[model samples]
Target: MKTIGVVDTTFARFNMGSAVVDEIKQHVSARIKRVTVPGIKDLPVASKKLIEEEDCDLVIALGMPGSKDIDKVCAHEASTGLIQAQLMTNRHIIEVFVHENEAGSDKELAYLMEKRSREHALNAVKLLFKPEELVKQAGTGQRQGFEDVGSIGM
Candidate 1:
């Protein structure tokens, strides 16, 4: 029953962006709102809006890569000269904490994300956030993603 908020920086690609969003929607079952603007700006605003409007239990920002792995965006300051231009005006990311702390660590990423999502779900349960409504969403098969996402942790 946890209301999770999600923001994605993949929309600059337009149709492809929306398609990616659709896939994520299926995967996360979280509240997602279309955002304008380019990269980092869209993310922070989307994150804030989703939290405020959805009363979200958690906020996640998603960024797609044009020429590199998602991790690379957080890895080198600039993967290539072309990316440097994008980073300058886009997800500037002067210091992305997740990358700075977790990079090259032995931790299993999928597991961590799942664990985090489950913790949010559990918190929603503890707060008596909205069991019956969530149950109905379950009836429609939308309630299982968070559990599966959390399973990535284990």
Candidate 2:
């Protein structure tokens, strides 16, 4: 069994990604490690290296999508948030996510979060069966899917 980390980020300048990681763990296997609510970010490079080197299994990153404007909803925003956040899911397996509180509590914000969550969830599913199929499963989001999940404005 692979040990996986489920992390959530909050207190960002925007609220699009918060309070949602809890909801998406439903599908992962019971053995997957669930990191508490503390966001994963700003770890020392050495620390980050250790986590990656720990040989856990996967370093799944989650995120929420919130924007008044339009974007393709890739894994980039989540990746940036991950680097800037104070938390990181350093494990293997799954990084399931769902949207909770975002930008303005507007319906659009909610919709985007949910959409991103679904993507995360779906990606998790694919990871389970494929594992090495990331490039095929994940879109061209710079560094997310490796980002932590947070608020959804719910």
Candidate 3:
């Protein structure tokens, strides 16, 4: 059985880790491990630990950046660290970040968080189990939280 790790931040307004786990469970049978940190910057180490210590095949790193310049900068820094962790572990860490300002209202924000989390969870499943599914959709514009802008005539 494959192990999927989920690292999320407590600073996020939504419980994206639960959303991810729920979505993954619907598609495949895998041991899902969850780790919660205080902020986005902590995602890399937690994810690395999940992969190196917990024996996870893949990790989903979820975070929400507030609507501020510093928050955006922190999000970028976290993303860079996540990339480094992936390189160090030679494993995939699916980065799912939803900026707080992406939506205009609370309802929209919640929807984006849920949709993005679930969609990325499915992507993780496909990556581990059926990567060819993704190859078939290549070049077709696919969006997670919003409507997919279909492929252009190439």
Every candidate's lDDT? 0.39, 0.41, 0.97
lDDT of 3 by residue, 79-153 (tens): 999999999999999999999999999899999999999999999999999999999889899999999999995
Model 3 misplaced regions, further than 4 Å? none
Q: Which ranges of candidate 2 are over 4 A from the true structure?
A: 12-30, 36-55, 63-105, 131-154
Q: How does residue 37 of candidate 1 score in lDDT?
A: 36
Candidate 2 has an lDDT of: 0.41
Order the candidate numbers by TM-score, best to worst. Answer: 3, 2, 1
Better of 1 and 2 by lDDT: 2
lDDT preference between candidates 1 and 3, better one: 3
Which stretches in model 1 have alpha-carbon errors above 4 Å?
Answer: 10-37, 65-154
- What is the C-alpha lDDT profile of model 1 across 1-154, one tens digit per residue? 4454444453322222343344444444545444433554345555555555656554444432333465456334323422443343332211111221222332443333333434433433433444575555443433321344322221
If scored against the real structure, what TM-score would every candidate get? 0.31, 0.43, 0.98
Model 2 lDDT at residue 7: 42
| Lowest summed lDDT window (length 10), candidate 1 | 91-100
lDDT of 2 by residue, 15-111 (tens): 3223233433555552343333333232222223434654334434543333423222433444454454325643333333333333345565556
